[model samples]
Target: MEGQLDHHPTPLGNWLEDLFAKLFYQPDDEICKKAMKEEMSPQLKVCINGQHVPREGFDQVITEARRTYNISVQNSRELLASPDATDKGIGSVAHIQTFTLEDKKTGNQRKQTSLTISVIAFSDGGKQLIELVEIVLDH
Candidate 1:
């Protein structure tokens, strides 16, 4: 933790809420899709349960989830956040949450509570974005 910033912030709630809403309910909205691009880095790295995944694959999962299930956020927590070393007031944010995914076509459901930690930063165009994320889940 020596190199990490000390601040803890959860200001991305609105952004997260919007992401889920648009991702699940409005997948075809051009404006929303355009805006969503600004929220994550093009070179984003995601590790779910210790398995690395590419950005394209990540987006596929989102698409699959949108088409296959109705996801409900049963519980959530903003564990921590810190600013970048440049003091631009951006760094990483962590959240732990339980989600209920009800199958869209089959009516089956599942819970996979997960802990997600993401490093956020300003892109070259001054847009806030998630660059790297690590996810651990309890099934």
Candidate 2:
């Protein structure tokens, strides 16, 4: 997919864009920590393919994964996105993003695309935070 940055029209859109961009450039522990502390809600949960990751383990799983794979964004496309469409200050996005993952030890690299959908809701202070994330690898 041809990488494009012309679709972020809302806070959720911008958040998704920023998330990928951060990983593309950094792909480090800092990004993972930042995502967990600043972006993901304390109650946040993630579903990868069919595996479920509860809030208690979300940070550890993600942090370990980030450390394991040197991932860089190759391209991204928004399949569907919305801004507060439900009048409950809720936003959602469905996207397909391509990334290049390199193994640190083996020095092997491959490109993979994943279909991801994320739900965002406004916090009490009016900041948008990711509440749920679902991703299907090799999609």
Candidate 3:
């Protein structure tokens, strides 16, 4: 489905947007680390391009991102939500992200890639903690 940015009225939507903002735009590693530790569940699962990424590898991912690419988040919006009978809910968020590869030695910008990311988030504990995150990249 095509993704559009809009103000989502639900609490879960607000939280998801805030998470994305801190993760993609904010450059502070400490803030990012705290957010991950506080917002993610102990059994959190993350996937990218249909491949599962170990929880322990998340720090590496962030480090790689900071070292390898200059990222800009064009937009992030909530697409849909599926709430269970309890407080758990699953939300789909769309992110328009642009990544430009950086040359390590020359500090030159290399290839630029713009993609839409469909993020599926499984939220529990009153939608405060994310238990699962599946990211699908669209070119």
Which residue pairs in candidate 1 have backbone atoms (N, alpha carbon, C) closer than 3 angstroms, thus clashing? none
Across 1-139, the per-residue lDDT of candidate 1 in tens digits comes to: 8985554445553345355456554546564456557676778787877788898887777767777887777876666665442355466666667878888888988887767776666785754556546564547
Q: Cα RMSD (Å) between model 1 and the true structure?
A: 4.9
lDDT of 2 by residue, 1-139 (tens): 3784566445466666686565344756677576657666777667777788887787676666577778777887776777463344368877787888788889888878788788877664544455555564553
TM-score of 1: 0.73
**Candidate 1: minimum summed lDDT over ten consecutive residues — where?**
8-17
Q: Lowest-scoring 10 consecutive residues by lDDT in candidate 3?
A: 111-120
Query: Which regions of candidate 1 deviate over 4 angstroms?
Result: 1-9, 12-32, 83-89, 136-138
- lDDT of candidate model 2 versus the reference: 0.67
Runs of candidate 3 exceeding 4 Å displacement:
1-9, 84-129, 133-138
lDDT of 3 by residue, 43-120 (tens): 666666567778778657866776665555554444444453114444543333344445555777644333233333
TM-scores for candidates 1 onward, in order: 0.73, 0.75, 0.61
**What local distance difference test score does each model get?**
0.65, 0.67, 0.54
Q: Cα deviation of 85 in candidate 1 (Å)?
A: 11
Which pairs of residues clash in candidate 2, taking residues 3 or more apart in a chain or in different chains? none
Query: Residue 132 in model 3: shift from native, Å?
Result: 3.8
